[model samples]
Target: MDKLKKNEKWFWGGVVLIELILFYSSSMTYKQQTSVPFLEKYVHGKPLKSSLSQIHFNYGGKEQSIANDGYYHFVEFFIRKGAHFGTYLILAVFLCLALYTYFKKNHFLNVFVPWLMTTGLAAFDEFHQGLTGGRTPSVTDVILDSAGALTGALIVVIITYFVIRHKNVKKV
Candidate 1:
């Protein structure tokens, strides 16, 4: 009935939506999940070719070289990793908000529980990926996801601290 209760419901809804998205994506094959065709149609250009060509690294036990693998694969690699980071970051934020609303008195649990849940979900996601065709699990991805979760949780913590401090100051 109150504003806090409504906000808590919204935050939990966001978490559920994110989980559904992850589940659907995990169910797809690697080829089905690739955004290469879309990128080639709209994003392919000389500037991308030049910039992406400069990037070379080893990922998933393979060399991601533009010259060897082509520009599309090279660009897709970053896009995929960014998606992983961004999705987990949002999930963490929602988790933090929902937990904070429910457990306002337990500040330690509010942060720790979200990080643990995000990390656990990341690991589970990787395991699910292994089940899909043409997809393999990566521990590195789990670490990256966890890092994103940490960043989001810290952002929430910092903002909450400042907002609460400001309110307390105003009351004096």
Candidate 2:
């Protein structure tokens, strides 16, 4: 392979490594995970929701807390799920790029491989979370993660199709 090809592979490999590091970091205790900038701001004080009407759901049969200091847990829940989506989306992008660089031209491989890889990783991530002291693993999160990966892969497919079409047009 050419130098550029090698460099691209290295770039994708680095992305995967960074993702793994993130996965490991997420395996930390709830306290460790919440010690970050924005979360730290609402870590302590009185419970935010006084009435049951404020909105919250049970995780592992235990009611999730709306934060102290009046931060709505409903908002936090979506933010957390959104983070999962964003991370998997990035993972899918890199995975698709790497596969395109290395594999033969095949529409199925381009989509299926990345989707399978991402879904598997998401499952493993949930399993890891289950092992963590305060984290609860949810199949719903796995579905959300897979959907994100699929969306990312589809975006790449659309862009690649247009790029290839443009190249052919230039050749014509």
Q: Mind giving the per-residue lDDT tens digits that candidate 1 earns over 1-172?
A: 1355569979999999999999899889988999889888888453568777787888667888889788877778889999999999999999998888765666677688999999999999999989998988999899999999988888887778788779889999
Candidate 1 local distance difference test against the native: 0.86
Among all candidates shown, the one with the greatest lDDT: 1
Kindly report which residue stretches of model 2 are placed more than 4 angstroms away from their true locations once superposed.
1-6, 35-70, 102-104
Candidate 2: clashing pairs of residues:
none
Give Cα distance to truth, residue 90, candidate 2, Å: 0.5
Error of 2 at 144 (Å): 0.5
Model 1: residues with Cα > 4 Å off, grouped in runs? 1-5, 102-107
Q: Per the 3 Å backbone cut-off, how many clashing residue pairs does candidate 2 have?
A: 0
CA-lDDT, candidates in order: 0.86, 0.73
